[model samples]
Target: MRDFRDAKAMAQTLRDALKAKSISVSHSESLELVAKTLGFHDWNVLSAAIQSSQPAAAKSPPALSFNGGTVIPVAPMRDIVFFPQLISPMFVGREKTRRAVESAAANDGRIVVITQRRAEDDDPDFDALYSVGVVADIMNRVELPNGNQKVRVSCGKRVAVVRPAEADFLAAEVVPLEEVRALDTQAFALTSEIFEAYRSSTNTVPPQSLYRYAGEPGVLADVVVQLLEIGVEKMQQALEIRDVVARLETILGWMRAGAPAKAS
Candidate 1:
């Protein structure tokens, strides 16, 4: 049994193990991998906890908001919001959410994930969930020994929930959201600044693949959204804006000035 007392050591061990398996991951990727392995949402969450010398319980889960086009099947999240462009590991204990995951996996793996406005609301109705959420494709599912199912979902785009969570699990009528991004010099510059803000705000290591999506306003917006510990309200505000530039500006302003960890 190997015990990890330090984050850097665990990262090196992870990097080495991956290397031994003939897998190559960049430093940032490795850090994020280790962070994920440690049960934190992302590298920033893990790094912050380690630096603060607090228990992992003291560490907050960084929630992201994801929304995209029309979709069926809804997965309600607890505590934190979810963002697109990231693969999330969700432990499903609720029967409805479990059924939703099973149903989505059986049917092309497409579903909408929405955060419950009240964290304690295990069974949320239409009004109990937020209006905006991310639509994603379920990539894989793993059944745990304790009966909880872990599902890996790849977020695609932002969306507005047209329908609500109902019946068994949650099924909603959702519409995919499209950002009106101006593909001009000003837009490009704002996108670049947004990326820089993301790079500056993140701790431990930033993701390497984020560069691939940097030029894409929607993807970049999502990538940045996931990395920050921004509140759910501001994130929802950012999600409602149809303009990519405006969303980026709102998020960037959050980055520069910072906000309370939890949404008010």
Candidate 2:
């Protein structure tokens, strides 16, 4: 039987080969191969070493939140947040979501975007949702070639969903989050530098609508937030900060430090 160390070395060689080719391999796959080569009956021996190292995919689907009242059945969708410096466009498909979009368009075109909590079991009666999200305003609407409706939305502000309300469409009673404290000038300066670097690297240009809707601070903050792949929790935390300068600094710090190493 092959020695365990020999098996490990073989697995490392495979990993190195894959990396050189720009092809990715999961740690689990390598562990399984090593176990089989080493004549091990079980693969769990490498459990501690072979945690999943894959990156998470894009944002979740959109979900609805009620502001004025509560609903018995909650409709869930994956939510994508638009940071102060970013802009996002979304498609509306479901009847409820389409209705929500129409209502927001009629009522100043504002909506809160938040992530949906996965159902605990097969049952869909779960009502729990993430509390943090961004408030966005519809900037433009267009009809796609396939007859789907595409809406361009720009980040308006950060908001926390205080309570869920019942509505025919997505609705939420959200109060704007306080700005981040500006006490960390060092953080702010560092973040700004990172933001500039990201923009240069990505070659992203702000939309004209952003110029119309965003104030000076909003423009800078939105740009940075748009670049980072932040999740519901981080987005919420950023929004909860009441100080504008501090919020920018927090986002900048995240950009510099990079995202969490683990996949979501």
Candidate 3:
């Protein structure tokens, strides 16, 4: 029943035992030794894992409107392009990104996740980021022992970044992009076909689990291709699409072309 969350108490016990043996080790050093005994690199990493495992207070997603006046902390994603209706977990290693995540976690857990044009850019300006990204809610976060933080986010809606503001962390003005729901007979039929294709390709059981999204073309397109062997560019392209039917068609095209499998 014991886990990383017990690390602090374990560290205290360790210190007490050491003191009984006339061993003088600082509390911090005892924590480090305990962390290592737990197979963690250091106390911070173990602490992060412990903190992240704690349950966050239940909170509803922020009520954001596409009014162009909505401002939020912007976190730059290095590799992945997030999409609406998708829940993703990512690591925050960059200092600015960690600050942004902290700011969002402190507030409403609402933040704009924009993908960088190049993953190599450590300090990317506004232009270096894709304008179209997802407005996501930070569901959970934990500080890692390696000076990085782990964040789990639930992507809500598509948004276009109006402009970036200068601040301690990157802040941006954005307007939510309305998905054009144009579901028709053809679109509906295509959705079912794509779901089957995804199931066949990925060999996932209980295909009915994805049936919840069967009625929503835009959401279906976003969720299915994410499981495919598509590149980030293709995924971003899918995010950029506003039309439901067009997005599905593009996703189908990728499937037919036999996109490269994602690296495990």
Candidate 4:
């Protein structure tokens, strides 16, 4: 059976076949026909609604629980969204963010990272940032000669920043967004499609490590997002999504649409 991609390709083929038959059908009309055949209002609508109807992240992650634990330090990432399994090199110059790093390092090296809603907001308050982010372990830090701090961290898991816990350094109460292991048939299929989409993308050069993460749906979704180098908005959407299947679909859909059609 043809999946969404395959079916779309068939739609294009139908358009070509119609022209070959000397039948008159405009390209846009053909697309509308294709959309109807696929049960959508039009191609534009199908593009957005082609995804699985269910919300994946709404299902709780297996084997993990959110323990706000102690309020880990909070670092506001400007124009960047971090995901688990990805290493991030961040430069800190802001006083609040630097202090947040130092405080987190003094403890268990855990910190909540949330993205500012606007990159230009130098002094971002809680209302200026996105609530969803990742909890990461600050693995290494060095004081640069330029009066800035260079930090390397590995993102752990998705988290929802509940609110600020008043403190001198930036600190936030966060709830861990638990994730489930991908062992189901649907997940396996989604993983396979994401791999294909990544391979097909013209703008992306997937890392060699892609194969290592492909079997695990969650990691695969993250890997594709990291490798594709898409916009921050798209990356944020992918990161906030919890359903391994839905996450994979979003990444795959973006990649598929990003590339131009191959020559026959």
Residue-wise lDDT of candidate 2 within 1-264, one digit each (tens)? 544545556777888888899988876577677776665422432321122111224322213232333222222345444465347677765677677777777776676665555523222221455555566778898888986688887765555554455677656555444344433555445544644545544566434433452334534565546546777567656654555676676776776576532111
lDDT ranking, high to low:
3, 4, 1, 2
Instruction: Write one digit per residue (lDDT tens) for candidate 4, span 1-264.
Output: 775445467777888898799987776677668877876534544543342222446434423333423567888888888888778788899999998999989878888888888899998887787767888889999899999999999988887664568887678766556555456678888877776665576435545567787668788778667666676787787877766777777777777788342211
- RMSD per prediction, one decimal? 18.8, 16.0, 21.8, 12.5
**Per-residue lDDT for 80-107 in model 1, tens only?**
6777666788778899888888888887
TM-score of each: 0.64, 0.50, 0.69, 0.70
- Measured with C-alpha atoms, the lDDT of residue 138 in candidate 4 is 92
Task: List the lowest-lDDT window of 10 residues for candidate 2.
Answer: 47-56
Model 4 pairs whose backbones collide: 57-243
Greater-TM-score candidate between 1 and 2: 1
lDDT of 3 by residue, 62-113 (tens): 2464333445899999888888877878888888888888888887889899
- Against the hidden true structure, what lDDT does model 1 obtain? 0.68
Query: Each prediction's Cα lDDT score?
Result: 0.68, 0.54, 0.76, 0.72
In model 1, what is the error at residue 144, expressed in angstroms?
1.3
- What TM-score does structure 4 among the candidates reach? 0.70
Output the better candidate (2/3) by TM-score.
3
